[model samples]
Target: MSLADLEPNSLHVVLHVRSHPPKANDFHWGLYLHRDFEAGGTKYHLKGADKRWLADHGTTRGVFKSFLLIGLCQVARIPSGLMKDVDAMFRTYDHQLNEMPGLTCRTWVFRVLELLQKPHSGQVLLECNDLTSLEYELLSWGNANALAAADCQQPRPTHRSDLCGL
Candidate 1:
């Protein structure tokens, strides 16, 4: 499925967790294309050791960190169709950030969404194979955002802090 199919200018936010011997063990998160497609940008595409990731970027290592997608949510589906190329846009966005090593995936999600134009539904939902910790931050992000939108006085708790133990 191509990201275009889900609807252009939309983001599919996913939460992942893997406590195995493959590599690092921790809760992870990433973004994915809504539709199965021929091609999309590096960030929008799910790049990793998988064949799907290799076919596109020619590297087993991809921009996305979360592998074993445990949960997902259409964080915001902008009705405004994206123009130019989604990948190209992401390149510009990433370059602007001057991404450094150890860049948090949550930060990536927060930043990429900034490029999209306004006027979108704030509602979000997550579906995971198992019921787990991903739900906590999912609600945390949503709750913190709602508080900010309303200009709440209390400082929201740092997300990554007790959530991931990172």
Candidate 2:
């Protein structure tokens, strides 16, 4: 989607998994914040690159993209300053190499999305086992989720409690 389409002051957070296989030191990524990532501005993310290959072309390699579409309550001015909380909450994720235990940029993005109460928690945005396989996995998951949502919306049969007074 075009950055211009985004309403003003709407913060967007995206997960960009690095381009590398598991067990590779270069297998890492980060949560990027920007209306238009390719346009570029102050982007936030964990910083690391063990190999030149990843370093050269790792950023923004993840094809799986999602949006937060921050509401006023999420980033609104409050008793605690908005920017203050924003910095504290987001900046820490950009910690230098190996600082956050086992969490990489990929995990960090997942956790951040979960913290914001986004769906698909604990799942990688761009797992690189096999591109074709991953596509099928995502499609199946999406279909199941849609079915579950549809089921929830279906009207339930009326119960005796509804006519108890009669």
Candidate 3:
């Protein structure tokens, strides 16, 4: 489906499990916004790994092509009619932050979440304040879903929104 098919103002955390060893258990995190969603009207994420990691893994940056989505959960909700602003903010935020040492998509996802929860953070809204718990819930959901490579990868869409079960 498309963003227009999702709930308005809803934000969900998207997780893609690494397929290779040595970091297979780890995941690349991203965000997905639903139709009329206040935060953003699209997916916000950093895919792929650093050059060295890429070289070692023989993979480039791209969803589905490089990794597979394993889990997702709704995390935040902003006010209606702010989709444009929030979408622009996230687009700029993604570029301004840049990828750095020790910073992965997971970092990007958490940073955005933190920003949305900051005091007086204009234009941004949240469904909850306890990110730690939200994170735990994601992990729990992943585990409960049996995060097996074969299980999570099969029977789902290759695109980001296909599995937007939210």
- TM-score for each predicted model, relative to the true structure: 0.41, 0.35, 0.64
Candidate 3, residue 53: the lDDT equals: 25
lDDT tens digits by residue: candidate 2, 1-166:
3433333322333322132221222223333332233542223445553321121112232212222111110121112223334445555444343455565554554455444332223433222334334334333333333332223422211111111121
Ranking by lDDT: 3, 1, 2
lDDT of 3 by residue, 1-166 (tens): 3333445666667676654331433666777665552332456777556522221111112222324566446665656666555565565554444344666677667777776665434543654566676667666555444355435445323122222222
- Candidate 3 lDDT at 124 equals 36
Q: Tens-digit lDDT track for model 1 on 1-166?
A: 2233344343455554443321323434555543223343233422333221211212122223233443335544333343234334445444433334434555455445454333223422222222235445575554334433233223222222232212
Higher-scoring candidate on lDDT, 1 or 3: 3
Q: Rate the local accuracy (lDDT) of all candidates.
A: 0.38, 0.31, 0.53
Q: Count the backbone clashes (under 3 Å) in each candidate.
A: 6, 1, 1
Error of 2 at 112 (Å): 3.6
Tell me how far the alpha carbon of residue 70 in candidate 1 is from the true structure, in angstroms, after superposition: 0.8
Q: Relative to the unseen true structure, what is the Cα RMSD of model 2? A: 15.4
Misplaced by over 4 Å in model 1 are: 1-10, 20-26, 36-67, 78-80, 83-86, 96-102, 117-166
lDDT of 1: 0.38
Off by over 4 Å in 2: 15-29, 32-41, 49-81, 93-97, 113-166
